[model samples]
Target chain A: MAANRSIDNFWAVIPAGGAGTRLWPLSRAGAPKFLHDLTGSGMSLLQETWARLAPLAEERFVVVTGRAHRAAVTEQLPSLGPGAVLAEPSPRDSMAAIGLAAALLERDDPDAVMGSFAADHVIADHEAFSESVRVAVDAARADWLVTLGIEPTFPSSAFGYIHLGEDLPGVTGARAVRAFVEKPSTDVAEGYLATGAYRWNAGMFVVRPGVLLDLLARWHPEFAAALRAIAADVSLLEELWPTLPKIALDHAIAEPAAEAGRVAVVPASFAWDDVGDFDSLAGLLDRSGAGTTVLGDSSLVRVFESSGLVVPRSGRVVAVVGLDDVVVVDTPDALLVTTRERAQQVKEIVAGLRDADRHDLT
Target chain B: MAANRSIDNFWAVIPAGGAGTRLWPLSRAGAPKFLHDLTGSGMSLLQETWARLAPLAEERFVVVTGRAHRAAVTEQLPSLGPGAVLAEPSPRDSMAAIGLAAALLERDDPDAVMGSFAADHVIADHEAFSESVRVAVDAARADWLVTLGIEPTFPSSAFGYIHLGEDLPGVTGARAVRAFVEKPSTDVAEGYLATGAYRWNAGMFVVRPGVLLDLLARWHPEFAAALRAIAADVSLLEELWPTLPKIALDHAIAEPAAEAGRVAVVPASFAWDDVGDFDSLAGLLDRSGAGTTVLGDSSLVRVFESSGLVVPRSGRVVAVVGLDDVVVVDTPDALLVTTRERAQQVKEIVAGLRDADRHDLT
Candidate 1:
């Protein structure tokens, strides 16, 4: 209940993966978005996530990442013990990634209430974020799969909406989720905002490790069993990780659980961003949302009469003149120039690079 | 006067100067616009100019450049003799550059008729250009300061206009110049284009070396004497060059000579471009001017739904997406991104870099 005190029996489960193709050149396949210091905070997104959760779950950290990134994750988080990092042989989507952490936590500590958060999200109000997680953890202790829903700041059609129902009878600040809606059109999102019951689904969930596995077992028995079997024997990971279904946790458990009146939501009013593209990144870095924003060394950027984002990572001087809302990402081997309006189309460039067998660039 | 055969007693005087601040990063103080191969050709602009003039002037070529660029000019023009490349101590403007070439040619060959052309202009029709030069040369032999007036294709406010008078009765394709107009506004340029008697003065002057100095003697007698004295004693070049008046040939002789009813114009129909800025460069390189155009190493550029010019000089892969009329010049030390409409403002960036003491980038 105390915001400053560490929560009892809480385990922080971080899933650090995603190429983030929309942020190419800055976020490449080998380095990815999570490993980058996109917020200009000196620490990368993964390190920031660890810093935020360390106070809430003291020394109870578990990071599951791709085999290629395991060493980098461990190196970035030196304080984390060798046994705390889990490396999956291949990508099997969020279900396997998060479920592996849950299965391991369920065997290590019987009273562990695991909170799963992505490694690349940015939260402005750390105190507000901590408060929301505290409430979510309390609801998870009651055996409910709780998600920390972000208060919608705009009618963005980019993310799904969580429809809130009546408040939970026992837990304060917790409400029963009425439904989980897929990403909708602008008009649909505007209508949803008018109703004042929708919150942006940021995909942050809190639940007991045993409760998550049990909920997954009810839907797909083999999936939960495979995760548990892999956790029982660490040597079976490489063979079992690829066999698990490649599905998101929302499709595997959250949506169906909400329909069965088992999912709870904590509507938090913190400024949160997944930094989906350069436009989102520009907004996140520049709170005023005007003028040119430099994410790397500001001395490397020379802008005039321009308003947008510039990531000068190549140590070369980047001079932008007379452009409005332009995004330029300069790396050592590749450079990307586009507009904020067309930031989503950056993924197309990455796809083209892969198709052309220029994977070194992608 | 045959267009295919070499003209008798003709010399090609190339005034290779100008830092081209508007084409910054690609055209720097050390490596100016004339040294760059902006046309996607393997040869530099100076080399291209030499190729265009070698057929007409045959071994009678003289290149006047700054002291810093003298070696580069000589290296680019290996066939030119050791005494052919003249290095200026400092930039003393067009009058000093061209007049020194004229004074030297006048002393070396009494019957010399020199055609002075810029080292960075792009000419499309080689035969038509040759024909224009031949007609101008014929008029120059008659002791007239003849300029090749380019037929105006559009109303351009960036260049000066030549007012045409009655045609010369003796020489075909030659017209007496009524006056020389400075760069005008768009509305004024439109009016000039509407008049059939106006032509774009491309600064291509062909004149007998003695007549050009005599024309200069009519107004700035001291300036002409100083240049001739420097030619008489080659060791006095650095000493007397600093004392020469810093004036363009257009103002020093062409305007005053035209007022005295002595200057003539050859109304040539060849397509010519100074490539004054990136917009002009884009138009010159992409005649159709609809899609993205890559200047250097087209294989290093990747584009999608974009139009304009991109120079990938750093051997980096430049990817542009969903931009219209954008200009991206990637160099080893600096990168520039702007729009074609604002390409002229790129000089502001170069100025800023110099003011900030980042001359290494400029």
Candidate 2:
């Protein structure tokens, strides 16, 4: 495994968050999805995220995470020093989390190109991902807010789509992002797929710190100034963090910038998964195709005439029989049994648990 | 709740055996189904069986179980005397397990009429069950090997059927056993259900101890003599028990006696369930028709649009979603997720575990 050479003036920004309630017991509030390895790989998703970026960013990295996960992020990515991992006083969603990182990086590296990626995504074929990042970094250096639009393999209504504009003159795979669309219906998604221009918006943004903050300042100047003020004082974070707007970066910046013709997309066909639910996790992990898939130790599972996923997280033996696409997630404190088609409805169970005051399980 | 009066010289013979592999993890090899309180009734199935028969037999009881399960059976039924519970050296099926008890009772009480009932069966109506046993005992007194035939509730192909002959002259519910047929096909079972002459063979037998051994002697003389010799001298149990035939009481005695016109059936309209699998166990424990049924503490389970039985035995929260007739059995070390329709297939999983040499789980 030959490592790619570190890119010049490039930094990595990892936003590790989300309770992942759809995944339920496997990914809980105490320990979210990024801290654990959803894939059977030895590395946690956060660690894998760091590994994927270390080749390009080398020692230049900034991690934005909630206060609850600060110690875990520090422990998981041991090479990241105290100054590198920024602990948010309170969650203000993606805009505040990523903008704070941008504000800090702008002061540290005057000519830096930062690629913002989520910590909980699964990326197969790292070579293709690296190539996309390399091109996105090039687009970012030119001050074009670069976003990697993943080539859609199927008509998945779960994800938002990116409409591409005319191709950038010099950049090989870079094209101007026309519009960032919200998640559409399956029938509508099929029409978008047939057009051969729409791509999955993976929320991967590459840009200079000034470019993202400048774009935010165009709409919410005070919000961008607050992030910069927190970056300047560092101690003002506790008081000013919660005062910022609670919104996703796509809605706050990316979607607006795309309409302004300031956002560019570098389309990559590498396999990517957000692992939003057990069904998606099962699909991402359906490699064995031997009727049943054991995401943990194979020895801990026993299946007969069954197909789908069985996660034995409690070191207990799980037996599934005569079921198709069934998902059984066994943990120390909770267990979930459902079909793949009903996996999205698992969030309803989490909501029910919350209503019943089962805070420990949710 | 009036307790039934003790019948003269009537002894209760409880044969507590079977691995109950269909129930798996909940009913393991080390802890069989008979020792568990599967119905959320606080008392185990073995205890429930003893309670039902204790009123009729008083202190006259003989429980034959495997050596491994002797302690558990005794612990569940603490009222039994020292010699009342017999521990077999090894499993030799129902014939050897029950015949040994009959031989011992034949000598202890010369006028003893013993009724043999399995320890793991669930009967809902105690009054009806008590009345049927009394009628079966009366038929037994007339020198007939009497069986309590349960009224078939459906066209079930899982159980053997008993064809009835003309009613006895004096006995109201007692009829001559025309034949004891094996498990029939569902189509054939439907025809059996249409005819009122067929009843499910619950394998319940009541007969005088001497008469039961005498009948055993006619077909298997040497086997009968060995059992009698063991009863006469308890020291020969470990030495001679292994040499006896391993056969069910039905195939070894009831079928032959029914063919010889020496068997009689007392049709009992009581609700009896073998609780053979999770499906039958679910059906038996479905006291509330609230769509979803919880067998253990109801508070520990959370369901959303699901129907079936959830046994939360591990003191952990179990959530089920968008499933119908689903069966979830959670234990400390193992868990089973399946549908009520495919409950029988769980036996194949148990066999697979045994074949894989996972005795710790099986």
Candidate 3:
């Protein structure tokens, strides 16, 4: 692998097929979280993600999404040509999604460095994020599997934690991965934060197509064989994609790579919010006691002035009185009111809507 | 004066013209307070008022409303034809409104006993209300001006107090009005309640056209003269109606009548609610502790289970978490969340809207 090579060899692969139930009512089955303008920003999360990566690797960008959201995915990212929308017949988790992207890139550049990015996360400090990705790509080009580790702001128990190890030999400002811990209890989360060695696993990774394939074959042969079979018929994705086993890249590759001491963590000092639920979004919004984000002609009046989160769309007004640590969202057809800590439980509302057969609202 | 006349002889004249500024956002200028289905019974306040009076009065109903609301008034009261919709050219206070109705009745039947009813009041007991009206009408026929007096349910300072004297002669349940007190201080209200002689002036009255006209001519000569002039030019309502002074019947007639010892009070035991503000409506709503009245597909969830009143419209869900004594009203264009006591101050919201030149909301 060449050192300090041109950025042209780096390709951005955005996996946007996740159903994203956490952001329900706004993000639906037909339109996943990537396409939604949750922050009231003019650009969708996927668009913003593309804008951040486009200047460095414009022509090498590829989006792997469900067949249902192909048109929306393409429409939002016009820089991506007709071939950019890689349609998955069904949602098979991130392993199949990333494998498909890597397999597709192999046809153009077999040794290309691929950066996997989730379509819904928000990175406020784009300069820092770009720098981190650039560092991660440099490590990936050297056959070192790189994962961008977000420096923890709060002891959030919702995300997986990355335990940092000794600094990587050649890669400056990067560390060898000591361990990967699943979501922990609050007490454990606080302990992890106090230790200062753990970073939030932001589910972003950088690796070469051949390196990822070789690692998957060595660790998870079954997934590797499935990916090989799918890659063989990548041109006829509609016919072969549905047969690929659904597994997240985290479980299939990242965990194994970390266990094998091949994974390096590029410490991300940037404000990277996964926007996993309304709570994460609360931190991003410019709010007072209660996290309230009023987008586009929306005003939030917190009567009790207690800590709560409210995100009302444009041309709407949400007045939250005597509420604390709650999330209130006002849409055209439906209004959602949930507690901030229980924002993840909002999926129940969507499930309830589905159970009631209100597909329109769900 | 006939003492045992059929209840049908007492025609109920409901003046639904007042554009009350107290109940704003929901109650607008185009659609006044009378038209709102605040009770979630499908029937509006005006409809409920008419229902309360319909059984007592033999379908001889007359609704005096502004020209702008004639269509809505007529539509709501389908039982009444064009004759029932008394279109006022402009907004004059209750004195001129009562005078005009009396003049119109004088042309039809001088001996007709008329019961003046506010279009937005809620009386729970129909039988007691009807009986009281009968007693008041009989007393009125004998030239004693009768006003229904509601026994105070609480030491409420929002309503004017009517002091009762000895029982009137010839009228079984009616008593002479000793004094008419304006809305009192809290201390005065407590004192009046303790005395057990003060009753809330129900804003209802019964009188014959000839007697009312004579009394008005004798006491408020200038106001009487203006109404007489307007009545003379029946076809020139637009030219004369706007010139009439905006004086309440309480200030112009009842106060003077009490001072002259000519006013009579009917001690009605019916359950009367003015339904004047959101607080009043909150009490009327069927809920225990602090809860809400949701109408038509609205779900009201009180998380902290504190006392609050949420009246979300049909097809909307309002969730009040960790709130107490707050009112949350969600509309398509605007959302109003105020303290339950400050709900009456929603009128200020309308005033602000007017000040901002947002007439569509007002």
Go through the candidates in order and give the clash count of each: 0, 0, 2
| TM-scores for the candidates | 0.98, 0.96, 0.86
User: Per TM-score, what order, best first?
Assistant: 1, 2, 3
CAPRI quality level assigned to candidate 3 from its DockQ score: acceptable
**What tens digits encode model 1's per-residue C-alpha lDDT throughout B1-362?**
45589998999999999999999989999999999998878888899899999899999999999999999999999999979998999999999999999999989999999999999999868889999999999899989999999998988888899999999879998999999999989899899888888999999999999999999998999999998998899889878989999999999999999999999999999899998999999999988989999998888999989999999999999999999999999999999999999999999999888889998988
Please tell me the TM-score of chain B in candidate 3 relative to the true structure's chain B.
Answer: 0.93
Better of 2 and 3 by TM-score: 2
Looking at every candidate separately, what fraction of the true A–B Cα contacts under 8 Å does it contain? 0.85, 0.87, 0.37
Off by over 4 Å in 1: none
Model 3, B9-121: lDDT tens digits are 67788899766666655677889889988777789999999988877775888888888999998899899879877888777878778888887776677678889999998
Stretches of candidate 2 off by over 4 Å are A1-3, A287-290, B1-3, B287-290
Error of 2 at B344 (Å): 1.0
- Model 1 RMSD, rounded to 1 decimal: 1.2
Docking class of 2: high
Query: Among the candidates, what TM-score does chain A have in each?
Result: 0.98, 0.97, 0.91
| Model 3, residue B206: C-alpha shift (Å) | 2.2
